[model samples]
Target: MGSPAERYTYPSPLAGFENAPPLPDEKNEDGKSFKNPPRDILSEAYTTFPEPLENGRRGAFDVHIYYFSSNKAYAKELWERIRREFPELRIYRFWDHPVGPHPVAMFEVNIFTPAQFGAFIPWLAIYRGPLSVLIHPNTVEGGEGVSHMDVERRNHSQRAIWMGERIPLDLDLFYAMGS
Candidate 1:
């Protein structure tokens, strides 16, 4: 093995692009140029749901719902599946939105009846998979005061997108933009 000195040598610039950052002045006053926008080196971008899923005032007897999915197609498939399997449950998504980079679906579940909401928990426990990382707050409200931000890169797993005659069980079948 090489000495620790050699192994832990400080990071040095790559051969050609040493000390280089994208040039900002490479564009015109029309504000339309550039191969790509400047990357967010010191920043982590953020995005909010298309709409907040909320219910009536707080009370043990109040309706309780969840903004369940950030992914539209998954949400629809799940909802349709649930509706068929469990026809008695009352679930609805007032606002349907798809957030890029997030494959999870989200929709507020309107629990207009507390008793019904209680019943929904059992089914949720069983069906909740990786998607269950989603949460149902006691009160659905603005994220400003919320302490947590759960952001995940899109899952390019087998189930990522549903298209074509055969459901792709591998990534090689998926389209990579401009394909």
Candidate 2:
């Protein structure tokens, strides 16, 4: 093996972009000035969500914090602290037993805006001692009188983001709904 420093040298994933071509600035190839400049459009803080999702629901995401029955006390303590800290968030009641698709006891927290998502998720990551957190986007295939339980299933299983141990969900709950 080479020296310790040289042995670990590997090209960065971004190295491919080093020689990438640059896009035209503000003006297009035709040289016609664009009405909305890139800088002007994003001057303010981007702390909002795409509200009223396709299904016309306000919450764009749901954060489920799960803990086993053995850790009920610790989980309850964390839930209380969350209530005190993030009063703005829609924190549902702490269930001591498994509820719906959740295979274990969990408390659901709905996130409305990007700001709440940015703030609360990281806080939970740091403070959720020995807890599993599931973050899933609410993706509804919008239409009139269309049952989208399949979409919901994909959201929970395929598109879900898990922090810490990934608890298996009882997917039968979705199927039982009978779309």
Candidate 3:
């Protein structure tokens, strides 16, 4: 029998994806086969958002800007600046202490369209300073009458995107409320 390292030389478990089947060639209008090109994700991102993210009121995502007690001054200043700069966005009041699932003090911002997300996220990247941001999608996944808390828990834990340091969320609150 070969040694463990030698046995895994070519098709190693870690590199298994390298052996995946090639993407199918696209059929052009003239009935010719050509290599399917990758989509321009950045350019298309400004216009296309998933249909599930279409909430009637509060928009597609929640952006949480978290701060420690030490950096409260800077966080507060940033929050004020966001309010002044993006007057169209739904900006919530700043909380001085941890609220709901969040571990630290944070102010919430809701953005509706993909264009807004493309614009504001980059602007925030430059201006956010030492604060960590949590961006989670909001969706009505189960259609008409299912529990919304289940969806909230999934979005906060599974679908969340973090900028800078990621904080551990207090998911026990979700469990309590969901029950």
Candidate 4:
């Protein structure tokens, strides 16, 4: 069996597809194979939410991540993986059922912190999700706009400035980022 990391590589067609296997050249009708793939998982939860939140004495810092993906399965997969790895992070869903909308799917996912937001990065990239983060380094005393920052697509990694003041925010900003 593949490990959790392996599961992130890529998913394949499961049994019981909408149409039978096709010949190399057969183009039936819908113009795509899984043109409306079935929904797999529609819900999620963190292993450490609600509790730590209620206990209060928040983490040193946190951030908000705003994103939209064109692929539903990919978004869902990323969401699940993010939850499994960083249960302390909270996630809110807004575009699960509208992938086929006019301009394709415009999903909104909010991640509360690196403890939770970082894990979602891999999935979002694989699923083609837009990434706009409100970063707050745990120890950095200032946010006078970073100096050297750029978003990379080749290796699936990049750096962007937080572009804000030194004042920090709590779960609300982060919770809102992912939305």
Write down the TM-score of every candidate.
0.29, 0.69, 0.73, 0.26
Across 86-106, the per-residue lDDT of candidate 2 in tens digits comes to 898788998878887998889
Model 3 compared with the native: what TM-score? 0.73
The C-alpha local distance difference test score for the whole of candidate 3 amounts to: 0.83
Question: 1-179 in candidate 4: lDDT tens per residue?
Answer: 24535423323444345575543654448766534433565323333333112223334233333334444454566667666765665454545332311122323334444335446555444543443444332222213432112101101111123322222223233224324
The per-model lDDT (C-alpha) reads 0.37, 0.75, 0.83, 0.37
| Preferred candidate (TM-score higher): 1 or 4 | 1
- Least accurate stretch of 10 residues (summed lDDT) in model 4? 150-159
Maximum-lDDT candidate: 3
Residue lDDT tens for model 1, 38-140: 5546322122121122334432111112234454455466567667865655555534433332232344343333444456555655554334323233324
Model 4 regions lying over 4 Å from their true place = 1-56, 69-73, 92-130, 137-179
- How many steric clashes between backbone atoms does each model show? 14, 0, 0, 4
* Candidate 3: clashing pairs of residues: none
Highest TM-score scorer: 3
Model 1, poorest ten-residue lDDT window? 150-159
Clashes of 2: 0
